[model samples]
Structures are given as structure tokens and as C-alpha cells.
Target: MTFQLRVLLVLAPILLPLRSSISQESAPTTTPLHRIVPQTPAELRELFRYTATRLPIVSAHRGGAGPGYPENCIATFEHTLAETFSMLEIDPRMTRDGHVVLHHDATLDRTTTGTGKLADKTLAELKQLRLKDSEGNVTDYQIPTLDEALRWAKGKTILVLDQKDVPLETRVGKISQHKAEAYAMMIVGSFKDVVACHRLNRDIMMEVMIPSHAKVQAFDALGVPWQNVIAFLGHVPPTDPSLYEAVHQKGASTMIGTSRNLDRVFHRRVRDAPDSLRRDYQMILGRGADVIETDLPREIGRLLYAPLSKSPLGHRLLRVE
Candidate 1:
């Protein structure tokens, strides 16, 4: 048999079982407050694909920031996972000594007790500093290495690694080293990055930012299979109705970011009004978003899952929500 035929034969067993699991069933009334991390690459891919289309797959922006739990910390991730099967969006940065660490800002001054650039500190030095919660209050939590975070997420929650200061090769290497290809996904900003990372490890899933239909087409031309990609539609409400359709046609899911919209629309106009929040969510879902990424996953998840009569809007925004 030829090489391609052999590859297909190998993949059939993994792909065949997924069809039955991926369904349009409604989400359970009570979301289990526990983590269910994918143990294998096939299981991870199946879960990722299923969740993307299943609607209301909450991705905790910066590890579900709240009162005591700080963003991107292990404790924060665990806290969010305990509430729902969340996808934690984390930033991976490299220290001066080359250890990959979980942190959002380039400087540790904002979230941690350390001062100056994070690149200036070694992993040991970075670890000694305590993390601060969302309210800027000091906590006992310390900065965790990317490896530590990935290992912790195993079989618990999905992890989306925001490529910040780290190189694609380095990040992919770490994921491979930890055997986290299933549990972790890297956010690639360009088509070149997508191709490069895929070439490095075809099993490594990617979250791509394809802002327009033209951009989506351009990415399609790169020949990376859509099954391995999750297209990001940006922070603003999408103007093109065809964008989501195009992505869906390619067998990929489109992610709509509500982090900016929460500040721009909900906070400014609604001011915590339940009715307005539901309307804004409906507007985004109406535009064909497969997944909603928000800073407030808990609140968004609640709104998405709220009963039709209780919700300001009568119709359900997401099928599973």
C-alpha cells in the first residue's frame, strides 16, 4: 500500500468513533463541576471538535479571572475547571534562563510581586514572587512553568496557549515533550505560523485569527486541514455573514471574542442588566459564532444556559447552552 493509504487506514479507527459522539444534543441542566481532560490525541481532537460545534463552550480568558483566583495561575485554572469543562486561555512567555512560564504581561509588576521585565528573571527568581488576584491583592500562588500548567491540565481542561514571547518551535516542542498535543492548542496569528507549526507536529491543534472571508480563503490555500484549526473572528461583531459559513463549510469552528464587547457594549450600555446581556449574546450567536470566548465565562455560561423564559430573550442562543 502507498504511504497516503496507510495514513488513512491508521486514522479511520480514530475518526470513525467520533461521529456518534458529536451530536446536537442539549447541554445538561447542571454542568458537572469537574475536569475531564482528553487522555489521547484522538480523544482530544474528538472532544475539541465536538465542543466547538456544540455551542457555549466557555473559554476562560486568562484562566477565568475572579476574586481570589488570579489569571493564568494553576489555582485559577483549577478553580475554573471545578465549575465547568472550560478551555483556559493562557499566555506563555520565556524567562532569561529559557524556562517557559505562564504569564500574560511582559512585565511581572502588574500581576506578580516582581518588578521589571519577566525576561530579566530566571525561573527560580520568577517562582519566588507571589501572584496577585484580579483586584491586585496578593495571593500565595506562585508563577508556574508552562510544563507545570500543562501537566496540571491533563484530563482536567483544555488549554489554549497564546503565543507571546515564545517561538512556535519552542512551544510545539514543549507540548510534544509533555505529550500534551491533545489537551493543548496554540494560537497562531498568521497563516505562515499555522503551516510551520503543522509541519512541526501535525497533531498540534491551532487557533487561527482569520479576520475576513478573503483571509480565510488565503488560509485554505495553505493546505492545512480545517479539522485541525479553530478560526478566531476577532473582538468586534463580524460584519460579514459569510465568514462563519465559510469556516463551517471548511469543517472548522469560528470563535467570537466578547472580552472587548463586554467592555464596549455591555458595561457601557447595559451596566449589568440581564436583559441587555442576553440580547448582546444573542446578537453574536445570531452572527454564527460557534464558540464564545469571554473574560466572564461563568456569567456568559449562565446566560447562555439560562431557561428561555428566565432569559430576556425567548430563544436559546446556543443549542447546548
Candidate 2:
């Protein structure tokens, strides 16, 4: 045998193993994605159903908009889902061309590079502009249509569609068109809207404001089943604990938002008194809130990640990969 051939043969096995090891070590690492994906409308309803042993959930306001992530952007939704198993709250507005897009304001100057009334812009025009993060920093992401958001959220997370310029019938139509009854719910302004939504699609659930006992009685009078809703208790915790029981007794879960109130405290103390902020969040859940809608879902998710991962409800509805 030639000398070179003999040397190559001798080194072949060792070189091959080292090459394999290096390949294994250098392969891209995939961060485990955490998500809440319900497969059916019934499953979705069950996830929000109140129970003594139910695990608390987070609802991301504006898809958890933050540094480097623009509100109402699909990338931001995925970014938040990567950290925690939470439902996303999105805003849907109508464009001049009659296309439904996810946007929070009537004007685009505040959240995008564009500087006009959103209603004056066509979807094509809006698509040409990039979205800005909460800090007013521009991002690479473009505005996603409600259709795009609905398709993207199928097995990743639930989207709570906040009513913007879009009519209730249109929103309901979009949800039905997407067959998104399993993963999409809407926020209705009143008992009339609630009844309208229920009439439109019984399979689709809603987030309705039922913060007061009088409203609760009005809601109950509608004869719409509690399974059709996740009651929103406004921007702060209700002073009456019985209000919680009233809803819970009807087999519905309750959601309280911190984006306006407690979330301000959290952001202010994010550097100094974070632990106290966490305790305050825990206290909200302690007061019978099944869900906390917050601008800082990632923070609440960090606090909930461990226990929720082990809870029965989490095991059934949450996906970690």
C-alpha cells in the first residue's frame, strides 16, 4: 500500500468521529416554544371555564408590544409566545379598500412610519409602511392583516380581537371565514353587541364588560349561556368580591386588565421593586381573576411558567416545543 493511503486509512475512523461530534455541537439550537393552542371551540371554552383548580393565564395586550417589538405585528405575537403560553389581544381596523387590518389607532403616525388617518390608507398603501415599536423605534415588520393574524394564530395562541373601526358583523364574518372559532374571540362593547355576536356565531366566544352587578344582571337577562363569554372586569380589580362569584357561579371565567393601572406600577418598579409588583399580580389572581390582561405578558409569564407547566389545565392546553 502507498504511504499516504496507509496514513489516511489509519486516521479515517478518528477523523470521522470528530467530524460527527463537531457537526452535532454546531447545529442550531431551537428555543422551546411555549403556547396555548386549543384544537376546538369546546376546548377553547373549557380553557376559560372557571374552576377551583384552574391555573391563571395571561392575555397579551397589543401582542405584548415592547422594545424591538411593534404592537399588532405578527413577529411580536411569536416573540411573546416564545416566552409564555398566553393568549394575545389584537386590534382590528378597516382600511379604505375595505380590508381588515390589525391596528390600534385611527391615525397611523403614532405606531407606524405613515402619517395619515388609517382609514384614508388602502391595505396596499399600509403594507408599504413599516410599524414602530412602543418606544417609537421603527421595525422591519410590516402591518399584518386580520386574515394573516388569524391564520398565524391557529396552533400557536388564541387572539382576543379588540373592536376598533371594524364593525361587529365584519369581525364575526372574518372569524367564521377563517374557521377560527377554536382560537379567536372578540371583545364586544355591550349586551347588544354580545347578543349580536352570539346570534352571528354561537361557536365564537367573547370578552364582555360585566364589571358591575347591574351589568351582570343585564347580561344574565340576555339568556346567553355563560360558556359564551370570558367576563372582563374593566381596568382595575372590582371592589366587590361577590361580583367574581356571580360570574363564577354562571360557569364563566373572569379577566381583569392591568395595562391601564397595575401595569403602570410594574413598569415603574421593573428595576427597583419587581418582587412587590409580582406579589400584586399574584394578589389579583388571588382575588379570583382567571386571567390578567397586561402589556407585560412576558413578565407575568416568567412568574407563571413553572407552576403552569405542571398544572392539569396547562398540560391539556399548553404546548412546549
Candidate 3:
């Protein structure tokens, strides 16, 4: 070998470690996690039960994904938990090979490196692809399975599983199989599905749409106790105060989805009137939304962060570090 080649080879080992060190230095560091741990399914229900002093909660829409974090990945979930004690909302779709994996779209083209219908691909095939962030930026994260997410969430954060292609029966089965009733719940769009879930496992909590007084009455008629459900009012605040009062009167907490409304406004005007935007969020809470489900969980969590509640359940269950 030439003298220059020999010298270069000798320096390669030294250069590689320096390069690695630089990468490690720039990598995101995790802070002490802000986690919620309910020891049992009963406690989990009690945690969601509407009360005068209940702590304000945030549900991380699509696991609080952002520029670097891909939605529904466990890593993204952890990153959100590190910042605030928020529950995760994930989409679970079935693969061709019959595995349930976390993916948001009907097609993989939007949120992943893969193309075409996600249902056509096996879990193994999906494992070969990488997930993408909301801005369509390719991320290093891989698609995670429902089982993997359930296992990871046990002592960390509660998961609210969105009904995508996965049937209500399958999602309930996965939660039952994992004994995840303590930290896992499902979103049911209809009262019949809610009833099906309750029949399958009464202990399993559910997020149900009760957007109007009529719907609230219909839900009440279903005879599923309010404690077993968290009523999702809608994407915006209710036009009638009675809607909030109706749900709260049933002893169930309420959730407002701000992803389509307030979250957009927050991101749009955050630089100008941040305080005013924050008040808008507070206004939702003031108007009787016990929970805020948003695309920007970390930002909402920070803005809505309140002192540990004096309520016994809130003190014991609402943990943040």
C-alpha cells in the first residue's frame, strides 16, 4: 500500500469514534418521564370519572407526533410522555397476515415509506418500511405492532386505540389478551359498537361520540354506565352549555378534539398572541371539557399544566416528574 493509504487507514479508527460521538451529542435526550399509572382497571375507570376536582388531561392524538416523531410509534409515545403525562391515541389496522399494527391511513403512502393499501401488506413486509411524520418527512421509526405498543404502555401511558380497519372485536380481544384494560381503551363511533365492547368486557373503557343532547340521551338509554365511557363532544365546543352539563351530569368526563380546530389556530398564531391562544384552550376547559385531544399534545399539555390536584385520585394517579 502507498504511504498515504496506510496513514489514512490508521486515522479511520480515530475519525469514526469522533463522528459517532458527535451524533450521540446531537441526539434527543429523554427527560424524566411524566407518567400515569393506574394499578387496576377499576382505578383506571375512577381516574376518568367526572369529578369537581379532576385533573385536566390531554390525549395525544396519534401519539403526539411532530416533525421528527412519526404518529403511533412507541418511541413517539415515549417522547410525548417525557414532556407531559398524556394518554396516547393510536390507530390500529390489520395486516394481510392477521397482525394488528399501528398505522393511521388506509394506504401506506401518506404516513410511511411504503405505497398502496396497508391491509394488503403483511406485518413482516411493513417492518421493512419506515414511518413518516406529518410533514411527509421520512423518519427513522418503524411501524409498531399493537401488541408491542400494549406491552410498552403498561406502566407508562394509557393508549386510546382508534378503530381503523381493525374491528371492535379484534381490538377488544387484543386488550383482553394483554390484560390491558388498565391502560388501554377503544374509540367506538356508534352506540351499538359501544354496547358490543361493553358486552365483550365491561371493564374496558371507551371513547364514544356524544356530540348532542339527543345523542347523549341515546347513550344514556344504552344503559352502559357513564364511568365506563369518556364522552367525545366533537371537534369543537358545543353550541349549547347543556351539552356539557348533560354529559357531566351523567358522571362521565368529556373530551373535545381540537386537532381540526383549536390546534390549527394555535399553530397558526402561536408566534403573535401566544397568551391569547392559550386562553382559548383554557376556555375549553373552563367550559367543561375534562380532556383535550389534540395533534399538539406537548404544547397543549404545557399550556394547560395545572398544579397537582388536591383530590386523592388525582394526587395518586396524575404523576409528573
Query: Which is the leading candidate under lDDT?
Result: 2
Question: What are the C-alpha RMSDs, in order, of all predicted structures?
Answer: 11.3, 14.0, 14.0
- Model 2 C-alpha lDDT per residue in residues 41-65, reported as the tens digit of each score: 9999999888776667889999988
TM-scores, all candidates, are: 0.81, 0.88, 0.88
Q: Using lDDT as the measure, name the better of candidate 2 and candidate 3.
A: 2
TM for candidate 2 is: 0.88
For 229-272, candidate 1 gives per-residue lDDT tens digits of 88898988596778877887787778878888663454334344
TM-score of 3: 0.88
Positional deviation of 65 in candidate 3, in angstroms?
0.9
**lDDT computed for candidate 2:** 0.82
lDDT per residue as tens, model 3, 102-167: 998899998999999999999899999999976789988999999999999998889999998899
Could you give the candidate ranking by TM-score, starting with the highest? Answer: 2, 3, 1
Q: How many clashes does the backbone of model 3 have?
A: 0
Q: Which residue pairs show backbone clashes in model 2?
A: none
